[model samples]
Structure formats: C-alpha cells, structure tokens
Target chain A: MRRLKALIKKEFHQIVRDPSSVMIAFILPLILLFLFGYGVSLDANRIDIGIVMQDNSPQVQSLIRAFENTSFLNAQVERDRREIEKQLVAGKLRGMVVIPTDFTRRLINPDDTAKLQVIADGSEPNTANFVQNYIRQTWVNWLLQSGLSEAMLTVDERVSIQPRFWFNPELESSHFLLSGSIAIIMTLIGTLLTSLVISREWERGTMEAMMATPVNIIEIILGKLIPYFVLGMSSMVICTIISIVVFGVPFRGSFITLAAVSAIFLITALQQGLLISTVAKNQFLASQMAFISGFLPAFILSGFVFEIKSMPAFVQAITYIVPAKYFVSCLQTLFLAGDIYSVIIPNVIGIMILGSVLFIVITRKTRKRLI
Target chain B: MLNRIKNLVIKEFLAIWRDKKSRVILIVPPMLQLFIFSFAATLEVKNVPIAVFNRDTGRESWELVQRFEGSPYFTDIHYIYSDKAVKEYINSQKALMVIQINDDFSSRINSGQQAEIQLILDGRKTNVSQILAGYVNGIIDRYNRDIKPEAQVRRSSQNAIRKGKLTASPFLSPASRSEIVPRNWFNENLDYIWFTVPGIVGILTMLISLIITSLSVAREREFGTFDQLLVSPLESTEILIGKTVPAFIIGMLEGTFFIIAGIVFFNLPHEGSFLHLYFGMSVFLLAIIGIGLLISSVSKTQQQAILGAFAFMTPTIILSGYATPIENMPLWLQEFTVINPLKHFLIIIKGVLLKNVPFDVVLEHTIPIAVFAVISLSVSTRMFKQRLE
Candidate 1:
C-alpha cells in the first residue's frame, strides 16, 4: 500500500510538472468547447439571391418586394443578366430570380403563365435545395396575398400532416454537437495523453528502471490509470459546464448516470492508449497509432459527424467496435433527453464490456519485464 | 551556404527513410484517409426507414405508399396498424419518420373534400428530418397534381389532339401555372463526391505537412540532437530549409496523390490550368509548414508539438469551409478566418478545379495565401533563430 501510494504521488508529480499534459487536460476543453459551440453550424439562412427584373410594373415590383421581406433571403437587384451570372459563378450569389420581361403582361391577362425562373448554384446541393424551397415558399405567399390562388386556397382538399419533432423541437444542432464534442474531447484527453506519457517513459529508459523495482504490473497500471482517470473526469466536468452554461445545451439526464457512463468511457479510452504504448514502445509510433486509432475513428465512425445508419453495411459493422459510438449515444441522450433507461442501459453496458476487455488485454500486455 | 543546405536536406531525407515503418506510415495513412473519408464523409441521406400507418385501403392511398417505396431515399417502409405502433417505432429509432394516413384520405379525394395525413419525424437528427420533410412534400405535391381536375381535363384534350380528333384550342386557360425552372451551375447533378475531392486535397495537404514538420525539430530536441545540428557549421536558415523542404516535398507528394485519386477514381473536374493549381498548392504548403515549424521551435518535446498542432488543426479545418461554408459562420468568426491559409487554399483549389476560373481569378485567391505564407515563414525563421541563441 505504501509503495502504491508513492507511485500514485509520483504519477501526479509527473502530470503536474509536465505543462503539456496539464494544458491538454484543462485548456484543450476550453478551445474545443468554444470551437464546437460557435464555429460549426449546419443551418443555411440569409441566402444571397440576385434578382434580375426586366419589367418595372407594380405587380412585378411587389413580387420582388415580397422576396426581400423574407428573413431567409437577401435580394440584390442587378440590371444586367451577365453581371448576375458572374456573381452566381463566383459564389457571391447563391441563386438568381429572373422576373421575365412579360411577367406583368402575363399576370394581368391571366391567359399566359407568368414564369419566374429560379437558377441555383448547384455546386453545393444542400444550399441549392434550401434556396429553391425558400423562393417557392415566398412565391406561394405572394400568390395568396395577390388573390390569384383564391380558388386553389378554397379547395383545401388534401392530407394534413402534422410533423412533431420529438427530442429536439427546434432542431438546434448545437445541443447534440456539444454533447458529441464531449465524447471527442474526452477521447483525446484520455488516449493521447496516456499514450504519450507511457511511451515517453519507454523512450527515456525509465520504464526499464521501474521494472527492476518491487513494483508489480498491476500497481504500475493503477498508478498510471488513476491520475488520468481524474484528469479525464475533470475535462468531462468542464465540458459539461461549458455545454450547459455557455452553449445553452440542456442537461436533461441525471448527473449520476452521466458520471458513471463517462467513467466507463474514460477507462476504455485510457486502456486503449496503454495497449498502444505497450505494443509500440516508441513515443512517435505510439502517438501516431493513438491518433489513427483514437482520433479518426472517434471523429468519423462514432456517429458524431456522420450517421452510422447512413453508412454502408460493412462500415456500419465497423462502427460497433468504436467505443466512442456507445458514448456518443449515451452522452447525446443524457444531454438532450432525460434518463431513458433503454438507451442509457444498453450503451453503458457496451462501454463497460469494451472497457473490461481492454483492461484485461492491457493487464496481460503489462508484464514485469520491459518490452 | 547552398551546398550546406543541400547536404542537410539529404540528411533529413535519410533520417526518415532509414525507418521502414515510418516510411510506410508516411505513404499509407494519407491514401487510406483519402478513400475512407471520401466515402464516409457524405451529406447524402439514403435508405431512411419510415413507418406508414395507412388506414385508408383506397387506390390513391396505396399509390401514395407506393411512391415512397419507389424512391431511392426511402426504404424499409414498415406498415404499422395503430398510432401506438408508430410511436414505439419512432421512440426506439427503428423508424426515423411515421406517415399516418387518415381513414378518409381516398374518400375525401373522391368527393373533392379535404383530407389530412400526419408525418411524425424524430427531430433529434434535424438535418435528416428537414431533408425527409422536403422529400415527403414533393411526393404529396405530385400526388395532388395527378388528381387535379384541371390537369385531368388538359390531359383528355391533349389525348384528343394527339389522335387528330380536334384542332388546337383557340381559348387559352386563365389558370395556367407559372413554372420555376431551376438550373444548377458548375455542378449540374450536385454530386457530393465532386464537391468533396478538391476540399479534401487542401485539407489532407495541410494536415500531412503540419504533422511532419511540427514533429521534425521537436523530435530532435526531445532526443537532444537539436544541439548537435545547432553546433554544426549549418546556419539557422540552412537548418530551417533542411527541415521544411522534406515536409514540403511530402505535402506536395500527398497533394499529387489526392489529385490523381480525385481525377481517376472520383472524376474530379480539372477546369483550370494545372500550373496554377500546383503553384497555389506549393504556397499553401509553405504557410502550413511555417505554422508547423513555429510549433516545433516553441515546444521542447514532440508531444507538445503534436498537441499544439492538434489545437491549431481543429479550428482551421472546421473554419476552412471544407465541411461547412465560411459565410454561414458568424460575422466575427468569418472575419477571423481571413488569416486562415487553409480557407484561402480551399477557395483557390475548389474554384480552379470546378469553376473553369481564369488565372486572374485564381490569383486573386492566391494573393492572400502568399501573404500568409510569407508572414508565417518569416515569423517562424525568427523564432528558430531566437531558439538557437
């Protein structure tokens, strides 16, 4: 027990003395939280749309004015069609609404259709679709206000679908992204820092010296694990505070559940790091392996940025192996929706099972002999 | 001085080449990331599982259900009996959306009365929900048009005219619909892969260069071999050149591999001059290498360097308009990205590749990148000189 205490104290000393580990543990969360909160947004609003109106009649002008009134569109009137095309190609204009020369004539006569051409820059299909939809919606309102669609409005004979979005009503992406960022940040803090410390000891020949002592493998593993476990949990707390307080992402689940699930995730992540360092025995290789195995999979396959269900069958199967996948599911549910036992239980169990398997493998790899 | 720089470059090259594992890592990961990320990082949603609570047994309602079944976007159309079943499926996430058709759907259509259908979507994934709603709206709109009294009358007239039973109608319809013809420029088909390839090239180049150069001097410092290079007759400039050239070469090599992969496999359009693309890429490399060198000179260990690089990388990549547009970011954040070399490079590379942009237009984007490269290189060289003292 005395030896274990001494080793724990030594590990704490190493962590505190090394400014990089301390910075990564505490400061990285600040940068990551701020970046995820403010920098990344998927919403496409205030789209710049160029308008080329050939007719100056009040009817044509009113339609253009209706477009300018909407919050989603910013309408800029350019006389020259070529100038508007230049803006579209340069990405300055997302789309163009060309009011034809005979727009007012056709509207007045009611015999000919008044066609409004909406040309969208399809390089980015997402934005293109949004622009097209917004334009059509604006046109619909104009038609109703003008009394042109009175007959159609009176018919009102169709299916009415009420769309109720269950968990996130407003569909604010920050809620889920903030929770997902916690998983990513915790994974980085646990895996990258742990791998670096162990591999640094190996590179500096300190591991060999430690192996000659009476300290056993379990003691060494615990001594290393305990400090980083605390570090990882501290980061999780910081992230939770930032997410709830700064980003305004609601924390719906119980704190006990969040803590338990986070502990399991951190354990799996740290053990994965320990296994990498033990196998590589080199700082560079360990860090690289940790990054490729830890960061990329956590970023990509964890369903943080990409949906696992949308992936191909083989890729979806591959995502089952990524520990962050289960953590992401648990964290998102915990942050956005309250304690749903079905989701939390399965994901937490997955993390626990993966963590235990990792713990056993690392234990087997960590003998009293130096690699 | 030139010869000393040359010899040092050779030394740097040999140092990396001596390690077989390191050599393989340098070559393999970039290629692997290219394929994996290109394939995986997609915004296109497909095979969305939706439950349909179709209470109506009429032909029109069945046709509506068949419409969803025929779409590539919608799949796994499970027919549930009750509202409870739909709720259960959605709550369990077995169905992302539930289409509830009212019993009077077909009857109301036949009687020309109003009918309603309810679409319950799991809004947890808002982006997907939004797109799914759009698809549903299109299907319902087409169905409404098919059953429209005016459209059916027009079809009968058109058939009579086709059979030469009547001349063209002298009277024009008063309620003729105005069509909104949408033309998507540059990328007519809106292929996500084509949009991704050029931006991927820029991002991959920046990452590879930053990692290699950031670790180069830091590795020597950690192993206490940096002092050996400092004590030698090599000038600080020579050492910087020796360190950065290898990273620059590796970055350019990776950029070339991406270009080839993008063209051969992804069919990425090369609309502008290759010379301009290479020039823009090299300047971009210079900017990132300088950032890496600055990180290396500041950190005493490779670990700190790696962390520093990671810190710089996360925001840069996020802000680079690679995954999301820069214009969508808040005004202050958008202004802040003026200094981001990656953002500038993405614009230049993507514009040149996809837009058939002229040289002057590409150069307009290139100017800021060049300015940033100069600033970063000069600052890093000054820092390296200070560290040597």
Candidate 2:
C-alpha cells in the first residue's frame, strides 16, 4: 500500500512537472467542448432559399411573406427559373418555392385548384427535403386560414397543433453538441494520452529499467496512473465549464453526477489505452490503434454523426461495447433535461460495467508483463 | 540527375522492404483508417420514426398518411392520439416530428379550404428538423393533390405553359412529354452515401497513412538509427525516397480497396474512366507523401512530429469541403484551400463518382494537385541532408 501511494505520487509529479501536459490537461478539453457546442450543429438555421413568385395577389403576397419571416428560411429572389437552378447547383439555395399564376383566384374558385411548386436540389437530400417541406407547410397554413380552401367553406373542422419541444425548449444546439463533445474529448484524450505515455516508456527502454527496480509493479503502474487520473478530472472540469459558461450550454443536471460518471469513463478509457500501449510498444502503431478503437468509435458509433435509434438493429447492438454511447446519453440528460434519475441510472450502470471489465483486463495485462 | 533520382528511388524501396516494421507501417494505417472511418464519417440521417395524429380520418388525410408511409426516409409511423402523446414522443426522442392533424382537416378539404398539420420537432438534434418539415410539406402537397379539382386543372394548363411563357405550339405538343422525363445521369436516387463514401475514403486513408509515416520516421531519428543512415553511404534522395514510397503504396492500395468496396457494397455505380482516376490519384498521392516527408524532416522527434501532423491534418480536413462546403468559407480561407492537395483530389473524385463528368472538365482541379505534388517533392528532397542539423 505504501509503495502504491509512492507510485501514485511519482505519477502526480510527472504530470505537474510537465508544463505542456498541464496546459493540455487544463485547456484542451474546455476548448474542444466549446467548439463542439457552438460549431458542430446539425440543425441548420437561417437557410438560404430562392423564390420566384409569378402571382401578384394578396394571397400570394401573404404566403410569400410567411416564408420570408420563417426562421429556417433566408428568402432570396432569382430573376428566372434558370437562375434559381444555377444558384441551387452552386449551393446558394437549398431549395426554391415557386408560386404559380392565378394562385389566389384558383384557390377561391369552386373548381380552381391552388398550387405551390417546390423544386429541390437532391444533391444534399437532407437539407433540400427540409426546405421543400417547411415552405409548403407554411403555404398550406396560409391557404387554410385565408378562407381559400373549398373544404373549409363546407365543413366546421379545425385542428389545433400545439407544438411542444422536449428536452430542449429553446432549441439550443449547444445542449446536444456539448454533451457529445465531452464523450469525444474524453475518448480522444483519455485513450490517446495514456497510450503514448506507456508506449514511450517501452520504446525508450524505461519499462525494462522500471521493472528491474525493487519497487512493486502495481506501485510503478499506480504512480504512472495517478497523474493521468488528476489530469483527466481537470480536463472534464474544463470541458464542463467551457460548455456551460463559454458556449452557453445548459447544465440542468447535478455536477456531482456528471463527475461520478466521468470518473468511471476516464478509468475505462485510460485502461483501454494502457492495454493497447503495453501490447504495441510503438508510438505510431499505438496512436493508430488508439485512433481506430477510441476516437473513431467516440466520433461515429457514440451517436455523434448519426442517430443510433435510426441505425439498423445489428449496428445498434454493436454500440453496446462503446462506453461513449452511455456517456453521451448521460451528458444530454445533464445538459438538456437536467438530471432525470430514470434516464441516468441505466447509463451509470452501463459505464461502471465497462470500467470494471476494462480495469480487470488492463490489470491482468500489466501483471503479465511484470511477471 | 534523372539517373541519380532513379537509383535513390530504388535504394529507398530496398531499404523499406528490409524492415518488417516499415512494411507493417505501410499496410496497417490506411486499412485501419478506411475500416474505421467508413463506419464513422456519415452525414445522412437514416430511419426517422414519425408519429402521425390523424384527426381528419377522411380520404385526403388517409392519402397524406399514405405518402409518409411510402417514403423509405421514414422508418416507422406510429398513430399518436393526443397532444400529450406528442409531448411524450419528443421528450423520449422516440420521434423527431409529430405530424398533428387539426380536428377540422376533412371538413376544410371538402370546402376547398387549406388544412394545416403542425410539425412539433424535438429540435434537440437540429440537423434533422428541417428534413422532417420537408417531408410533412410533401405529404400535404399530396393531400392537396388528391382533394383539389383546381390542382388537376392547373396541371393541364401547365402542360400548355413552358418556362412561365405560353407559346402557341398546338401543332407539336408531342415534345412536352420528354420534358417530364429527367433520367438522372450518375445516381438516379442520388443516395447521400454515394456522394460521401469515395471522398471520405480518400481523406481518411490519407490522414492515417501520412500521419503514421511522418511520426515513424521522426521516431527513428529521435531514437537514433538516423546516425546510422548518415554513415551508411545512402544518398539524400535515396533516403527520402526510401521513407516515402512504402507509405505511398500503402495509401494507394487502401484507397483502391475502398473504391472497389464503394462500388460493390454501397451500390455506387462508377461512370468515370479507371485510367483517369489512377492518373489523378497518383498525382494526389505524391503530393500528400511529400507533405508527410516535409513534416518528418522539420520535426524534432516522434511526439512533436505527430502533434504537428495533427495540426496540419485538422485544418486540411476542415478546409477540404468535407464537413462544411469550402465555397461558404471566407475569401481568405477559401484562397488558403487552393494550396491543399486534398481539396483538389476530393473535387476530382466527387466529379468522377458523383457527377460522372468528362475528365477534361475536372482537369482544372486535377492540375493543382499535380502542381502541389511537384512543389512538396522538390522542397522535401532539397531539404534532405545526411545529418540532423
């Protein structure tokens, strides 16, 4: 126990002594979290749209006004259909809303049908589809309310669409992105930093020298780890502060809950790195492996780029092994929903399960190397 | 000078083959990156589940619901009963959008008035919100089409009108049908995966290979086989060639494997010339390898070199029109992208694979990459010296 304490002290010394490590430990996570919170938004706002209204009626004008006012659309007029297509090809317009001639007279007439044509560039299918739908819905709403629809003249029907946004009320992109950023930064730094340290020692022959000492193997290992553990905590704190204070990401959940989950996740991540480093013992190879197993999984499989709920059954099943998956859920609850006990309980359990397994495997891997 | 470079190139190849680790370095990085990044780098949001509140229960609303169900974009459609149910869906994030039907939906349609369906999006994940709104609009349009007789009359009139100009061509209205036929050139469905997979494969493979090569060579120098190389009578050109070619071949092999996989697995049909692709690829490969060699030369050790490579790669990825469009970048940042070989290479690949345009059309993009290759190669080779100083 005394040897283990001394080893941990050595690890702390190594971390405090290196200025670059200290700066990275204190600053990088915070910066990364802010970038993720602010810059990495999937929800496109103020989208550029092209409009060429042929109808000059009050009905058409009001419909056009509705589109221009919508937050999603940044409406612009193209001189002609050719110009609209050109702008779309150049990526200036996400889509085009064309109001045809006699749009008002046709809707008011018993037999005349009112139409709004949507021309979307299928190049970016996601954004194009969204623009088409939003403008069309607005037009439909205008047509309905203006007493232009033949059906409303005959029927007493009306729908009250009460819109309520869950988890995010104000719909800030920061809440979603900040949480995901914590998972990514933790995976990248946690797995990557630990791997390089152990790999460097092995490459420089320090591992063999350390093994020859009278000190216990666990003591040396603990010494190597204590500094990184503190560094990881500092990084998590930096990330949380940057996301909450700098980028205006909400922290509705308790900080203690966030820290508890982060501790387990960091332990698992660092152990994962240590296991790979002990096996590879080459910086390039170790870094490559770390990129593949740690960063890539965190970036992709942890519900970052694509929604895991939308993935195929087999792919969703594969996500169970990646600890970032659980962490991302935990972060969202903390930042957006503010500490839902039911939501967090399972995620905490999942993280602990991963941490315990990884810890056992790494300890065994380190012990074998010592023996 | 040509003969000397050739001899050096041969010596470089021989030395790389002599070291087993060098072979591992060549083969592993690119393959690993390709496998990992293919799964990682996706922008397409698949399988959106939507909750539909059908208040009308009329033929128009049914037809509108049919359109949503028919679209492959929507995975599952649940019948939502109350506004509270919509709220629950949003909170759980089980549904991105709740298409709420107004109580007077059928009556409004019957009276030739408009009906509204409110799209209550989770908005927690903003990227998909706009897309869901689009789908709702499309369904409403279909709803309008089924119920409105005026829509049918306008369609017949549009048959007479062309480009907002009404021409008196009653004699030869036969050509009107062809205007309706838009046979898409390369991708008929325009799958997002088809557009992204090839470019991503090139970038991810290049990132891993270049990064590993730069750091590995610097590691050797940091650990001291560099002194042995200086004493071993290997010329500077030979040393540079030896360091670069192995990784270059590995990067190319990895790229080629992904190209094949894209065609076979992702259902991306290729329309461009194989020879043209190979030509563009070789030039781009030479450029990136040159940059990696330069990074290795300037860096103090493996660690510093790796960090430096990361700094370079991050900006390259950001500016390469991967995550965001480069044209949207500020003027100076856009100008800065002119020097990045990856940007040119991506345009070439996207042109061939997605647009299926003629090679000459994209020659403007290809030439700059070749130029970057020449510049990087010349600089790295000139800077190469036997000693660390």
Listed in order, each prediction's TM-score against the native is 0.93, 0.78
lDDT of 1: 0.81
CAPRI grade, predicted model 1 = acceptable
Please list the residue runs of candidate 1 whose C-alpha ends up more than 4 Å from where it truly belongs after superposition: A102-114, A155-157, A360-371, B55-60, B150-175
The candidate that wins on TM-score is: 1
Candidate 1 lDDT, A239-331, residue by residue in tens: 899889888898889999999899989999999988888887777777777877788788778877677777777777877888999999888
Task: Write model 2 residue lDDT over A1-371, tens digit each, in one string.
Answer: 77777777776676676544554465556555544543355555566888877778776677778888777688886547777755554445767777667666754553434566676655454555456556755665554455333232222222223455656667666578777778888887777778877888888898888788888767776776677887888878877777778777777789888888888888888888888788778777677777768876787788765677655566678789899988887787777777667667888889889888887887788777666
Per-residue error at B88 for model 2, in Å? 5.7
lDDT of 1 at B139: 82
